[model samples]
Target chain A: MQYQSQAVAKLYFTAAIGLFAGQILFGLILGLQYVVGDFLFPEIPFNVARMVHTNLLIVWILFGFMGAAYYLVPEEAERELHSPGLAVLMFWVFLVAGALTILGYLLVPYSGLAKMTGNDLLPTMGREFLEQPTITKIGIVIVALAFLYNIGMTILSGRKTVVNLVLLIGLAGLAVLFLFAFYNPDNLVEDKLYWWWVVHLWVEGVWELILGSILAFVLIKTTGVDREVIEKWLYVIIAMTLITGIIGTGHHYYWIGTPEYWQWWGSVFSALEPIPFFMMTVFAFNMVNRRRRNHLNKVAVLWALGTAVMAFLGAGVWGFLHTLSPVNYYTHGSQITAAHGHMAFYGAYAMIVLTIISYAMPMMRGRKAANSNRSQVLEMWSFWLMTVSMVFITLFLTGAGILQVYLQRYSDTPLPFMVVQEKIALFYWMREVAGVVFLAGLVLYIASFFVGSKDPEAAVEQAASPTA
Target chain B: MTRGGSLPETSRYPPGDLAVWIFILAELAVFAIFFAAYAFTRMQHVALFDQYQATLDRNAALFNTLALVTASYFVVRAVTAIREGRTASARNRLWAAVGMGGLFLLVKGMEYAHHLGEGIRLSTNAFYMFYLSLTFFHFMHVILGILVLMVLAMRTAAGHYSAQSHTDIESGASYWHMVDLVWLILFPLVYVMH
Candidate 1:
């Protein structure tokens, strides 16, 4: 809000929320398909629905990161964005491409869509998350290039703060690593090996730098903590992140046809991955405890701290559970992976996007500091509902996974996959119910924006949060 | 970091910034896990480990240990020198520590070349896998420690440290000691333990 060009983030934030809703809806559909088997039948098909769900999640999170950068870079650099016009143009380009891609997934059979999109020339369509056609992938590269150019120019043209520098490094690392997606080796092992350079390197590796910088920016504003203090810790946290995360790539190399040393290397390193997250959790709490002023935006601070704890639990604690090569031997592709995936994504990435949105959205709309008390109350309601529901979903999937692993993979007389799945259908039913509650929370979250536009920001509360 | 205790000067606790201590503890925890993995795996394969343990060149490892221990001694001298306002002496001590670190790396590098000459790799066998992985990991730490010592040496030469303001020296010294400490454990567990 300090710079006129910061207004452009409003457009990207709105799109991110819209696509986030679409993702959760598709997620609910996928969850139902898990329990009911043929509920959607061949009309929408489970595979296509899953693709839509995951692809939408990635697209929306990218939208969120772009929006965050647009808002943050201007303020951190003490200047306007280099070109807000290009920012808006790229938003529309990304949105339209995202929409057309989703439509193609729904309308055409996946293989036929692959053929129609000229998959023969560069066959990148059938991969797990890179399910986008080669043309769309090229479009993504173009959009990313334009976006990086805009942000990069703004940082170089103005004062370079540590936050902006770290973010630039992270964003640049993201673009460079995405080029790995194009390297599709015919050897499945090699293919899987490099695929992690895109996925694991993003979430665990450089993306952490982005997360630390953004969280540092928010803490500086809300807690009035010293920038030097936050910047120093940011360096330590990101250093730990890459130190553990880079070699932490060894975890994935274990079962893949890699060398035997990965067993020790992967276990030792990935087991330490939780340390950075644990430090993040401690750092967030410590900053809030040392706050100088009581900011009006209590909810944003809540979202920030909530993200820290949940990310540690979901990504750190849960990840540590099955990461040891010995333990992974029994639970490689079981529902345990599902349980970890659901919570880790929601806690780490999804909640971060929501945190920045919560902090910036009110100011972009011309509010003084925060949303009205009513809106914040409802947002906190949504926060707990969604977060708690996710916990339930993870626990249910974990329960189903343990049972499935025992009955199907571990027992003396092992049951077949389908039989074990049938025995574990009850957990799936409970998960569907939790997924419904989550949808309700998302509805409340969106409704909060509209519910109190006219009301003044909330008066200061006297009681501090327990951790604070 | 002690609560309700004497202050830093009096207590001599941990001897550096809490941030550096956090990293030091994390690094130690990782090495602890690696050692545990080595011990647990050794328990399962005692004969293989014992048979391969003899193949290691103990003379080179013993010399590397001496090099690291001497480097740590020099770091302690550098910190003490800075505390006494002896800038030139501190810079000389730091450079001496860096030299010792170089000696360790040179010896370790020769050891690696010997292993590679024997066609041994991380995948050759479990014994070789843990041995190479653990030693090479500690070897990287030695290189990093030498870089730190060189930087500290340059800064000391430029008069950046004083008797009252030498926490950076303590922090660097703390880290180098950690690198040395890990090798002390690794040398015995991987190279000498039966």
Candidate 2:
């Protein structure tokens, strides 16, 4: 609201929410297919729907990150954006390309879509999470470049605060790492090796920089804490992140035709990855507790605190559950990976986006600072509902995973994969039920924005005496 | 800065920035796990471990341990010098500490060269894998410790810390001690505890 260009973030955030809802719908469908098997056959097969589910998630999160950068960089720099016009243009370009890619996945078979997109020239399709056609990948690069140019120019021209610098570094890193997606080697082992450079490096590596900066910005604004204190914590947290995370990449190298040294190196470093997240949780709480002013945005405060805790639980504790090579030898591709993925993505990445959105959306929408009490109450309700259901979803999948691993991998006479799947159908049904509640929570989250638009902003301390 | 400095010194709390302390704790936690893993793995391969453990140069390790311990003692002197407002004395102490770290590295480097000359590596066996991993990890900390000591020396020359305000010196010195302390454990655990 302070800068005209910041309004462009409203468009990005809105689009992010829309795509988020689509992701949940597809997620529910995928969950049902896990139990019912062929619920949406022929027209929407499992592979296609799974790709749509994951791709939508990645795109929407990218949008959310871009939106968060657009919103915070200007305020941190004390200047208007360099090119709001370019930002708006790239927004549409990225959205349309993303939508078309999803449509291609749905309408065309995998092989036909690959051919349609000229996959013969550069074969990057069929990889999990990097399933985009080569053309769309190129389009993503273009959009990322333009977006970075605009943001980078603005930060360079304006006041160079730590928040701006860290965010730019993170965004730049995201773009640079995505280039690895194009390195599709013919050797399967080599392909898998570099593939993690994109996936693992992003989520575990640079994306953490993005997450840390955004959480810092929100906490600074809502708590009225000194920028110096928060920035110090930010530097230490990120330093720890890189120190542990870079070498932590070895965890994925195990079983990928890598050397035996990776087992020792990977286990040693990755076992320490949870420390930064623990520090992050401590940092968020300490800032809020020492807050100078209690901002009227209660829900934003909740989100800021919730982000730190959930990230620690989902990404930190759950990741440690099977990070060791010995443990991972059994649970490598099992549902435990799925369990960890769901919570880690939702808890770390997804909630941080929602945290920024929750904190910034109010001011963008022309409120004094926060939403009316009714809306806040509803938003808090939605936060808990979504968060608790995600916990259940993760737990149910973990149950199914442990049972599956026991029956299929660790048994004296191991059962076949499909037979184990049928045996664990009950857990899948429970997971699908949790998925439904999550979708419902998403519905309420969207509705919270509209429910109390006309009411006066809720005061921090309610009026004491009524005057006639 | 948040809580410790405000509390009375009688509280027996740490004497540096809280942020660095958190970092130190995390780093220590990592070393602890690595040590535990080493012990657990060594239990299974006691014969291989004992066999390869004999190949290590105990005299060189003893010399490195002494060098690191001497460096840590110099840092302690540097901190005390700064606490008493002797900037010149602090600078000299930090230099001595860095010199000790360099000596440790020099002796350790020769050991590494000897091993490489024998064509030993992390892939040689389970014992060598852990021996090289744990020692190299501690070795990197020595390099970092030297760098920290040099920076502290430079800052002391610039009069950045004194009796009134020397948290930077305390933090840097404390980190150097952590490096040295890890070596104390790492030296015996890896080189002598067979």
Give the winner by TM-score: 1
Q: What is the C-alpha lDDT profile of model 1 across A1-468, one tens digit per residue?
A: 789999999999999999999999999989899878897788889999999999999999899999999999999999999999999999999999999999999998999898999999987778889899999999999999999999999999998999999999998998889888888999999999999999999989888888888898999999999998888788778878988999999888889898878878888899999999999999999999999988888889999999898889888988988899999889988999899989988988899889999999999999878999889989999999999999999999999999999999999999999999899999999999999999999999999999988888776663244334
Model 1 docking grade: medium
The TM-score measured for candidate 1 stands at: 0.95
Pairs of colliding residues, candidate 2: none
| Candidate 2, DockQ score (0 to 1) | 0.71
Question: Candidate 2's residue-wise lDDT over A325-438, tens digit each?
Answer: 999999989999999999999999999999999989999999878899889889999999999999999999999999999999998999999999999999999999999999
Cα lDDT of candidate 2 equals 0.91
Off by over 4 Å in 1: A460-468, B1-9, B158-160
Pairs in steric clash, model 1: none
Error of 1 at A345 (Å): 0.6
